[model samples]
Target: MKRRTTERKMTDKERKFLVELLACTPSKFKRWMEGAQNALVLWAASMLGMVLGWLILAWLIHLLVNLEVGMRSPYALGVVSLLAPVCGLYAICSSVQWVRNWPDPSEALRQDISGGKVLDETYNVIEAKRFKEPEHGGLIYFLRMDDDRVLVIYDHESIALEMEGENALSSSFEPRRELHIVRAPSTEYILEQEFSGEKLELSAPVDLTVPPDQWPEQESWCEIPWLELERRLGMPGF
Candidate 1:
C-alpha cells in the first residue's frame, strides 16, 4: 500500500511539472539556456560551422577544379562530391542573412503562438481586413501589439496584436485599385472577435483573459502596408 501511494504521488508530481514547463514563451531549448553559461558553447559551434563551410566552398571553387563542370565520369564524380561545400556555404550565408533580416524575436514568437498550438490543437486565430485590387495591387496595415508578451499557456494559442514599429504607408496603387480604412482603438483591442468591414470587431473575447507576461518593452508596432492589409482581409474596394 505504501509503495502504491508513493508511485501515485510521483506520477502526479511529474504531470504537474510538465504542465508548468509548457507554459512558457521561449522554447524549451531557449528557456534551458536562458541563464546557463553553457549556452555560449552552442553559439560557438554554430559560428564554427559557418566559417568552415565558407572555407570549404572557397577551396572547392578556386583550388579543386580549374575547369568548368564536365559530363559524368570518375573525375566529375570527385568534383560533384564537392557540391557539399557549395551547399554548406549557402547554409552559412542564409544564417547570417536571417539574422540581418528579422525584426526581432517578437515577430517569431508571435507567429508561433498565433497558430494557437500552444493552448490547443483545434484553436487558431487569424487577423482580418478588407481590400480591393483594381489597376494594380493595394496595400493595408496590420497592427501588432508591442505591449503584449505571450507565454505558451497550457497549450492555448495566442493571437498577436500590434507591431514592433509604426509607419505611414500608401493607401492605394492605381485608379481602379482603391481602398478604405477603418481604425480601432489601441486600448480596447480584444483577442476574441475577427475584424469586420471597416472596423475592428474581435471575437473570442472570453478566450482572451489577461496575458501571461506584462507588456513588451515597446508599446505598439505594425507590420502591414495599409493597402495590403485590406487585400489580405478580403475587403473589396468601392
Candidate 2:
C-alpha cells in the first residue's frame, strides 16, 4: 500500500470566503441539484420512449394492414411511428411527475420533518431510539413547533428545520450550555423554548458525538440575535 500524503489546508481568506458562501440560503444550491437530476431522468425516459414507440407503431400498422403478404403501409406507418415516440415521451414525463407527487409512507415523517408541502407539523413521538445502523445514529428529537415548523433535533450541536419544497435548513449552534434561538428560520438554529399551546418540552439535553448523514457539516456556527432570543424565552422586553 502507498503511504498517504498530507493534504493542503485552506488559507484564512479561502476559509472566510467559504463561510460567506455557506451563509447564502440553499435555494440556488438545491435548484442546481434538481436540474441535474431532471436532465438524467429525462434522458432515461427518452430511451424508454424509443422502445415503447417502436412497439406502438408496429402494432398500429399490424392492425391497419394485418401484415398481409407483400403488403406494407410505409406512408401511414411513417406518420404513426413519428407520433408514437412523442406520445410515449409525454406519457413517461407525466407518470414521473405523478409518482413524485405521490405520498410515500416511509417518507412521511421525513417529509413532515423536512417541511414539505403536506408537512405534518403534528406527530406523536412513536419511538425515539439511538441506533448505529444509519452510520452511528445520533440523538434525534421530533418536535412540532408553534409556528408549524417540524424540527428534528439531531443533537445538541446541530438541528434540522424542515422547510417547504423537500428542503431543510440544517444549522449548527454555538456549543455552549446557554440556550439560544431565533424567532424564525435562519442560517444558524439555536435551541430555545418557543411559546406553545401543546407545551412541548425536551426530556433533557441530548448530546451526540457524531453528526447525522443529512446534516451539513460546517466549520462555522452562527449565534442568534440576542434580543430575539430573549423575546422567545419570555424575558423582559427591552
lDDT winner:
2
Query: Model 2: per-residue lDDT, tens digit, 101-215?
Result: 5433333223322331211112232222111112332234433322332334444322223222221213332122122232112222221232222333323333233335334
Instruction: Give candidate 1 regions above 4 Å deviation.
Output: 1-23, 27-71, 99-238
Q: lDDT value for candidate 1? A: 0.31
What lDDT is obtained when candidate 2 is compared to the true structure?
Answer: 0.36
Q: Residue 90's C-alpha lDDT in candidate 2? A: 64
Each prediction's TM-score versus the true structure: 0.25, 0.29
Query: Pairing residues by index, what is the TM-score of model 2?
Result: 0.29
**Whole-model Cα lDDT of every candidate shown, in order:** 0.31, 0.36
Model 1: per-residue lDDT, tens digit, 1-238?
0101011111333334333433643554553444242334444565566556655665566566764334333455655456545545555555555444533343434443333222111112123222222212222223322222111111111111112122112222111111112111222111222222233342211111223232122213323343343333343333
* Model 2 lDDT, residue 237, Cα: 14
| Candidate 1, position 206, lDDT | 18
